[model samples]
Target: MSSAAPLLLSPKEVNLLKQSPTPISILDATWFMPNVARNATDEFLSKRIPGAQFLDLDDVASPHELGLKHMMPDQKKFSQACERLGVTPSSHVVLYDTHSVFSSPRALFMFRSFGHQNSSVINGGLPRWVHEGLPIERNSPSMIPSSHYEPPHFDARLIRDYQQIVENSKLDPQTNPDAEIVLDARAHGRYLGAVPEPRPELSSGHIPNSFSLPFNLFLQKQGTPDGEYTTFLPEQELRAALDNVVGAQYAEKIISGERPVVTSCGSGMTAGVLWLGLSLLGAKNIGLYDESWTGYAMRPSSKIVKTA
Candidate 1:
């Protein structure tokens, strides 16, 4: 792993890294919706890329009293989790997921927020690796001693809390010039209150004034003998999707670091897809609403809008 390794690595590049003399850490950062029956760790134990360790998103998250899923952990907790996972400040952390592009980017964002800049996500993840006839193994990963990491303060610029999101929502361009555009990554139906949310207690609607750009628009599905698997869309398609939602001018500003963008979704999982798509375009000043709609809609103080 060179100092210049890309943030998004291909399956072939990962194969090359396997043969490299440089120290690299491969982590399977697979996570699924609560409604989904599959357990990510169990799936990892059943099959994974050779020498890959499980980086459970749930275990890395700080538990909420309101039962929110995958909230960002505190700095000490994150440091301990990374150390336990055998990651060091210098390690080229390679993130991948069982479900193509889903959870790996979230893990990447977590690493970046924790000031670990040497991490990258496998572009198509483990399914693509297996689809290319790459090797797989079921044996437990070899145990390595902890790195005893002392992490830097979490990057507040990369995250937006409920209070900040609410304040941003109320901003008028005439008064507050630095307000960020809020983008919701949930499906249109959910965003518009036409469909029920997965959580029975939560209502379907988006934060006021947020644009509805579904996360799936940033992905493509390729068919294999086993089944259809998801991967990111081409760079051109990603740009077009962003253009369609935010308009080409604003999209260009977002890519060029002139405008800020904050992404949100159901409990903040698929928001990572939006963040990763923007990153591919070399976008800057991006933030994630970690509490997202789950935290927003649960509070009576927050306003929700429905167009459907």
Candidate 2:
């Protein structure tokens, strides 16, 4: 909790700060899967944390100009959106979602990319909070009046374009070596081409030379059967899980800002979860492949590996 980097806050930790004089902004950034019919806005309107604002990921954080889903917006657009949400530069933002650890991490990563250093994600999101008997509001909270928000120079190092990914995919540690490590956060079945992709046009498989480390591995089920919620593991367990993929020494290098980590997923959404995990460990050189497999699969020249 005392670390300089962003950390996940427990429900109890959030409750203790209910009376703190510092400005804390809560954001409900719930985003459902494509097949799910539930509307996040309607859910937020029905019930949400007290004083929480709704951030529509598809609307507020996406770049419509690129014709892609949930792409990061430019600095000016992101600044304007944050201003409309009444998020000042000094605000300590806390994001949560209905689906536990799914969508909130994306919002956290977005905030960090925009140079907001004080952002964090609730460990188990709304479900855990409700399960813990914390207070909730039925009516939609009134939005604070707009404020001015100016972001620092946008950092391109936090993002990896398709060309960069393609180039990285070709590097072989056995022969040509590089400091960059590419991680894929998709299911093992999807990564091995044993399961079909959600998108029909995109083929199932993974980027060449990328290691598989599904994002859900970091999450553990909490709460009772009636209201089960997913939350991140304890620091020791989380570190062990990460060390399994990148080895303990390399993981330490990543945490100490010595090596670069690049994360990718089906369409770039779950990649945020991996980015968040690295960020929690204080990894400074983190990058996300914005287009992910959706873009890579469509390119005939891109290298893809399938176990089956």
Candidate 3:
């Protein structure tokens, strides 16, 4: 795989790559909420990209006693999972999900955190691929067992713990110039405490000083004769959205690498969308609060802010 791979690939680009002599390693990282009746694995088994393997989010995540979902796994565990999925150091890993841009970014985040930079996500995921008449197969791809892929140490710089977030919450950016910006990717209602969280045990509120920029804002819907599909917005429009959420000055600072950003969401899934958006804008200093609100709100020591 070329190290200079683009972070996002269109379905047309992906289709052309599949026809190459050495095709890319495509992963179906489709996942859904517990209440959703869909089974990602079963769906993948029935229909998926022609040469794609399934990446079970639950199987790769660390088992949390507190039930914090989608927590990053240890380097060894992650390395094993990738090897089992036939990913190698030279593989140009391409990730996609059944939903329109939902779960694939999280899987891409996991790859980047594990030091695999030679990877990309299908821009509109499987939905858009199907919408454009891309080839798919019901049978699983033939696996060429990876020769003990060694994952580099998990990038600590891309991850934030609960305590780190709490400390950040107490800082006033006005007082501390280096204070990081925290952005939540949950829905507006959930961020405002006006909508109940899907997790019954958790309350709906945001971390102090965190801005709510729903993950969907980064994507634009395109209506076709077949149906509607979602894809990332053009760069100019995305920059405008960022400027509107956090002033133009702050957005410029982030793009210039002078300011840092940490993204969070209900259980740390959609947070990747925020991280990916920032990265697309050329932001180098970005982190994911893996535990996110699920790990934060449950702790009595952490403070929660409710606008509604």
Question: Highest TM-score: which candidate?
Answer: 3
Extract clashing residue pairs from model 3.
Answer: none
**Model 1 per-residue lDDT tens digits across residues 13-48:** 988987988778899999999889999989999999
Q: What is the C-alpha RMSD of each candidate to the true structure, in Å?
A: 2.0, 2.4, 1.6
Off by over 4 Å in 3: 140-144
Winner of 1 and 2 under TM-score: 1
| Per-model TM values vs. the true structure | 0.95, 0.93, 0.96
Report clashes for each candidate as comma-separated counts. Answer: 0, 0, 0
Candidate 2: give the clashing pairs. Answer: none
Q: Which sequence of candidate numbers ranks them by TM-score, best first?
A: 3, 1, 2
Decide which is better by lDDT, 1 or 3.
1
Locate the minimum summed-lDDT window of 10 residues in model 1. Answer: 170-179
Off by over 4 Å in 2: 1-6, 62-66
For candidate 3, give the lDDT.
0.86
Best by lDDT: 1
Residue 161, model 3: lDDT of 89
